[model samples]
Target: MVAMPEPSAPLSLRHRLAQNLRRLRLERQWSQEDLAERSGLHHNQISMIERARSSVGIDIVEKLMAALGVRASDLLD
Candidate 1:
């Protein structure tokens, strides 16, 4: 039987982005649902993004940046 490889640690960049995104949302006192409504995205999607479980798209990033009033670089940083 082929053994499955162990999972590696999550990327720091992704983790950092997740942390930053959550911080930004909390800074504005916005819930995932609130941010979802503002960004025209699903709350589940926002949850996935914040958890770094989903790959972020440019469009979603733009929407988040707009909704959160932050620059793309700021969030990614």
Candidate 2:
């Protein structure tokens, strides 16, 4: 199993993105499949992103932002 980071430890950009993505998705009442369909990505891709198991390119980020009706900064910061 993968180890989880300590709560006190600062998250890396990838992990921060993952956390924010999941939060935003949930706030919108969307499942991974829903996000994937809206983003034109596969559900597996969304899962990987939410888990921080995949490094996303700017194009993918743009897709997600558009699908989620959020800005790039919302996902990053």
> Model 1: residues >4 Å from true position, as ranges?
1-11
What's the C-alpha lDDT at position 1 in model 1?
27
Task: Quote the positional error of residue 49 for candidate 1 in Å.
Answer: 0.5
Write down the TM-score for model 1. 0.82
| Residue-by-residue lDDT tens digits, candidate 2, 1-77 | 34558899988888888999999999999999999999999999999889988999999999999999999999998
lDDT per residue (tens digit) for residues 34-59 in model 1: 99999999999999888877788788
Measured by TM-score, the strongest candidate is 2
Candidate 2, position 23, lDDT: 99
Count the clashes in each prediction: 0, 0
In model 1, the Cα lDDT at residue 43 comes to 98
TM-score of each: 0.82, 0.93
| Index of the highest-lDDT prediction | 2
